[model samples]
Target: MRVFIVHAHHEPTSFNHAMTSEAVAVLTGAGHEVMVSDLYAMGFDPVSDRRNFVTVTDSEKLNQQSEEAYASAHQGYAPDLQAEMDKLAWCDILIFQFPIWWLGFPAILKGWVDRVFAVGRAYGGGRWFDSGVFAGKRAMCSMTVGGPAPVYTDSGVYGSIGSILHPIHRGIFGFTGFTVIEPFVVYDPKRLGDEERLACLARYSERLLVLDSAPTIENPNTADYEGFVLKSVQDKHRGLD
Candidate 1:
């Protein structure tokens, strides 16, 4: 499978960087194609605005969605943004490798989504969720946490990690029609010993090889809903991976 990994971390020697490097090495060694976008190294801009498009829908106020739709039709997105979209289109798997900050993705990664995952290209019109543009693809979040695993649990100080990542898994990956596999989270890498870190990398390598058979989080099927809400109690029984 062709995989696109977007790596967002500033430190080259950091564990986050190690994870991305390990992923590329392991995936490529397995004979799978891989492409990586290291946001910081690329000097990627996190801000999204009129700069996102070379095609202008309106010269006055900025309506990003409207402009995106127009750009999608006219190939108006700036070359850089369009390039990212092309990578997304080419990949069978999409992975966001980053350090979780404030319970979410970094600004650069978020902006990557804001600009690249635009209307008509990623999602728009009647296409979303199970029917979204990337319906056949699979996506995963590989992140490092600031705290220990226990701190991110149900009764822990930060609540459940699943709850913290709901917006990303459901709103972005799921909404865009990618089957989101369970996130691979490394908690408090700063606290881990060198041996532990090496073991962690080994574990990640194993995870990459079995992604096809890995457990996936369920996403609501559009068929089970009407007007974006569940149609009936029976609708709850049907879900898509």
Candidate 2:
């Protein structure tokens, strides 16, 4: 399987970096083709500008042919968007490795989504909101957090980690039509000893190797959601009547 690993951690010696490396090793050793996009290392521009809105025109060619060719060739094609799009298109599985900053993905990763997941590429005018270019693909988040697991659990201070990550799981990956597997989170990195860290790393490595073996959740699209909304509305009206 072609795997695309997008690493968003800034620190070279951080636990997130180590996990990214371990994932790469495991995937590569399993004979899967892996591509790493280190956002910070690559100096990825996260800004989405007006230049992306300008349409490419070839007036010299016939109108229909030019438009068709341009639309076909340039579907979700832009200078800033091409690199990540190419990588996304090339991969069957996408693993996002990062540190959970402020209970979410790092700014760079968020920016990556903002810039790369643009109109005509990730979403568009005529395209269905939930049906993006990445449908049928699989995604997983391998994240490291500073807080303990207990803090993120139900009835804890931070609430459930799964609930905290619902927006990312439902809004981003599920909305874009990728089958999102359960995230693998490592908590309380600062509290771990060297030996414990090593054990954790080994376990993480094993998870990466057999990621496909885990069952994926069903990704509901806009159509599915619309039906639910319509049913709810009908039920409300019937109750009133």
Candidate 3:
């Protein structure tokens, strides 16, 4: 398997770094090719705009999607974006390693998504959900949370973890056509003892070994919807054909 990890933590000594390192070591040791994009280290500019493409569809106003479409047709992606797109195309499994900040991806990571997930290259023109541009690939989030598991539960203050991650899982990975793997989350890692941290790494290694077989979240079938609303829901008002 080929794995590409997009790491989004600034601190080298952080637990997120350890998770990424563990993934690279484990995957490489298992004979899988691995690549890491250390966003902070790379000094990646997360801001999306004309900076994403070398071509312009409009000069007076900025229409990002139009520019992206033009870039896709003209090979005009900025060198940095092109490199990231190449890796995304090359990988079988994509992993996002980051600390969950305020119930979502860090601004840098979110910006990475804004810039990297282009219209023509990633999704557009009836390409989304199961039929997205990355249809055959798989993606997973390896995240560390500041709070404990219970705090993220349905009845807890932070709400369900699954709901919290819906934007990334459903909107991003699933929309882009990657099989969404159940996230591997580390909660309150800072409070864990050395032994516990080591155990987490061991468990992560185990997950890496079974990347292909890992259980995945199901994506909505594009066939079931007319545009965005479910056909079943639409049928409730009108009789089914």
Candidate 4:
């Protein structure tokens, strides 16, 4: 399988790096192709603006969608962004590797999405949800959080882990037509003992190999929605009709 890992942590010796390193070794050892974009090492620009594209749609004003569509048609994206887009297109499975911060992705990782997932490229026109540009591909978040697992449960002060990552799973991966896999979460790795940390790494190795059979989060079909709202018949089952 072709795997593309977007790695976000700044420190090379971090647990996040260990996860990515383990992934590369295991995957490559299995004869799978693996590519990693070390964002901090590469000094990736996270800002989304005209800098994203080499072509201009409107010199007087900035309309990201309009500009992106034009860029998509003319091959006008900046070299860096275009390269990332190429990797997105090349991968069969996409893995976002990062430590969760403030219940979400680190700024650099979030910026990668902002800049790379452009209109007419990632999504635009009628391409979204199940019909999205990358419909058959799969994407997953392999993340580390500073808190205990129980803290992210439904009853915890912080919301459930599912709820916290909903935007990324549904809005980003699902919306772009990539099947969303259940996230591989390592909780408070910094607090874990050496053996425990190694166990987590071993678990991650197993998870990566079985990704095709890995549990996936279900997403509502685009066909069930009209104007992005589910029809009454569909909602009725949930008592939301």
Candidate 1 versus the native: TM-score?
A: 0.93
Whole-model lDDT values for every prediction = 0.91, 0.76, 0.92, 0.93
The reply for model 2, stretches above 4 Å from the true place, is 51-76, 124-132, 228-241
lDDT of 1 by residue, 122-221 (tens): 9988788899999999999999999999999999999997999898899999998999999999999999899999999999999999877788999887
> Residue 72 in candidate 4 has what lDDT?
97
Q: lDDT tens string, model 3, 1-241?
A: 9999999999999999999999988899889999999999999999998889888879999998888889999999999999999999999999999998988999999999999999888999888888889998999999999999999999999998799999999999999899999999999999989999999999989998998989999888677444446666678769873
The model with the greater lDDT, 1 or 4, is: 4
Error of 4 at 183 (Å): 0.5
lDDT of 2: 0.76
Q: Which stretches of model 1 miss by more than 4 angstroms?
A: 225-241
Per-residue accuracy of model 4 over 1-241 as CA lDDT, tens digit each: 9999999999988999999999999999999999999999999999999999999979999989899999999999999999999999999999999999998899999999999999989998878888899999999999999999989999997989899999999989999999999999999999999999999999999999987778999876668444445456567878985
lDDT of 3: 0.92
Show where candidate 3 strays beyond 4 Å.
227-241
Worst 10 residues of 1 by lDDT: 225-234
Q: How close is each model in CA RMSD to the real structure?
A: 4.8, 5.7, 2.9, 3.7
Model 2, 1-241: lDDT tens digits are 8999989988899998888888888888989999999999998876654333334565454343334335445562455557787888788889889888898888889888766655445544434425656776788988888898889989989888788888877777877667788889899887889999999999998788777776665567768877877888998989942
Error of 4 at 207 (Å): 0.2
Note the clash tally of each candidate: 0, 0, 0, 0
